[model samples]
Target: MAIKYGRPIELREISRRDGATASPALDLTVRPRRNRKAEWARRMVRENVLTTDDLIWPLFLIDGNGKREQIASMPGVDRLSVDQAVREAERAMKLTIPCIALFPYTDPSLRDEEGTEATNPDNLVCRTVRAIKKEFPDLGILCDVALDPFTSHGHDGLIADGKILNDETVAVLVRQALVQAEAGCDIIAPSDMMDGRVAAIREGLDRTGLLDVQIMAYAAKYASAFYGPFRDAIGSAKTLTGDKRTYQMDSANSDEALREVELDISEGADMVMVKPGMPYLDVVRRVKDTFAMPTFAYQVSGEYAMIAAAAGNGWLDGDRAMMESLLAFKRAGADGVLSYFAPKAAEQLKAQG
Candidate 1:
């Protein structure tokens, strides 16, 4: 049965008269796809933009000279020698990368339980810093103030009686920051995840008349599984006795990361960062939104491995994926990203401009 002229009619008479005031089912007033129809329109309406200035390259340092030995887990990363590191810094300048973070691979003979090599005024990191500063005096150099690279047991803090020591370990980290500052390191990044270390490092630097050196605190570093290849690069994976869950942030908590960031900022950190970036992007966004400070994120080793591995195997276009990932950090409110793909991404951005 059908309705014709506002009355019931037989099925045979349905097409004979008007059944209804026919109209289209949907009357759409707004179409979002209009803006997405052209590349120029999409670019004009982009919410966030990523540029070469938003990248910080991390360079691993080794003991010898002229060696560029690659790590097995990390696809393209290598431990560069001091002279080679200087050349790389020059390359970074050419690429317009504002900063290059240095991580040293200390010799096994130098590592000990107390991580005393960290305080040596002439260690690998200090030497490399001096070398780079000599050639590229204006390029910002950031040194990590964690003991794991120099500790025999592969922990970021001093250990005593099967426990990670806090206050005592902070004393050593203070000296480590002092030495790096004295060696012309512009920023001291305390990735040790120890309580009150940022305040201690800041005080120590000021006492030594190095008032201009900045402190970039790894405020929300988590004991994440993504650090395996990073530990391998820094020669810590082999000797690591236990996990760092005691000090590093718990993955189960988001508010705790905000608390950690708050504490570090109160303690005199010039900048704050959330480690193992992609998984903790919400934390990154929270920290940035809450404090409105200079916030950074570390695109950790495992994230790099996943992208590089997939790209190497012809599973994806590496360049586009890398750009999209970095842009995601920007979308998450990161001021900059410490990434292994910094150089490559910078080149791509420069090409685009």
Candidate 2:
């Protein structure tokens, strides 16, 4: 029988050469693919959606005027000077990105074993925060409250006899949080993964009367190899003396992530984040489901580098991959994602409308 164009056809039994009738249809009631048959239908039934509001741009800060230094490992990302950072902040605001996370590339001369520059109000990160907040009062700024960028040894906390001192580091992290809050940072993100830091920083913030500032804890950060490009971006790759397995979570542990998140939440973390997002999406899903808090994921530099490398080689559709990866974060119950592709993804979303 000939088929007609653009019309549903009724199924009928067909005769076989052996005199047995072949049924044209089986007992099927549900068709999941039917909703995905068209672009509009697929969009209408999409379980997760990514938008500018769901993005937090992770920007690197450097010390100079009108400077934009490209990070070789992470293509399309730059370490912007305070002046240049302000421009980037304005652009982010225009793109409707709600916040920007700042990681500074501190000069080697300023870095010390104690990471003293971390508490300096005039340091690169603090200055960048001040500049951005001055130019755009409404633009949210998230500052990294860790010592790695300012430490000569490149550890996130104070080191003594090859050990990362927990209480000593928490004291310094409290000071660092105060500096960032004083500089008008909207979020003091403790990415150090040190024990009892959230409570320490929270108490410090309260004592300083910066009561409105929020803490976005790096609750489930892993000691994964995926952080190479990020360490490069912040100029910490060369200074890092050893691995962070003692402090950061193990890649093999999922239940440990939930415990970490629970601790941070109990210690007054306003939001929580899981690092190296794509690889740890199961952890993200579990954390979100268990806590039902504002959870975020960081699409770390290595993930961005791989995509950019493949796209540069003409092996992948960069734009589509970026959007899909971000959408996957939303699918995993992330309220937002910290990504290197924030600006590009925002542009794509804007163009779609």
Question: Which residue pairs show collisions in model 1?
Answer: none
For model 1, state the Cα shift of residue 37 in Å: 0.9
TM-score of decoy 2: 0.93
TM for candidate 1 is 0.93
lDDT of 2 at 10: 33
Candidate 1 residues 214-305, lDDT tens each?
99999999999999999999999999997999999889999999999999999999999999999999999999999999999999999999
What is the model-wide C-alpha lDDT for candidate 2? 0.92
lDDT of 2 by residue, 1-353 (tens): 32323332333233344223433244457867679879999989878888899999999988889899999999889999999999999999999999999999999999999999999988988888888898899989999899999999999999999999999999999999999899999999999999999999999999989999999999999998999999998888988998999999999999999999999999999999999899999999999999999999999999999999999999999988999899999999999999999999999899988
Candidate 1 worst ten-residue window by lDDT: 16-25
Q: List the residue pairs that clash in candidate 2.
A: none
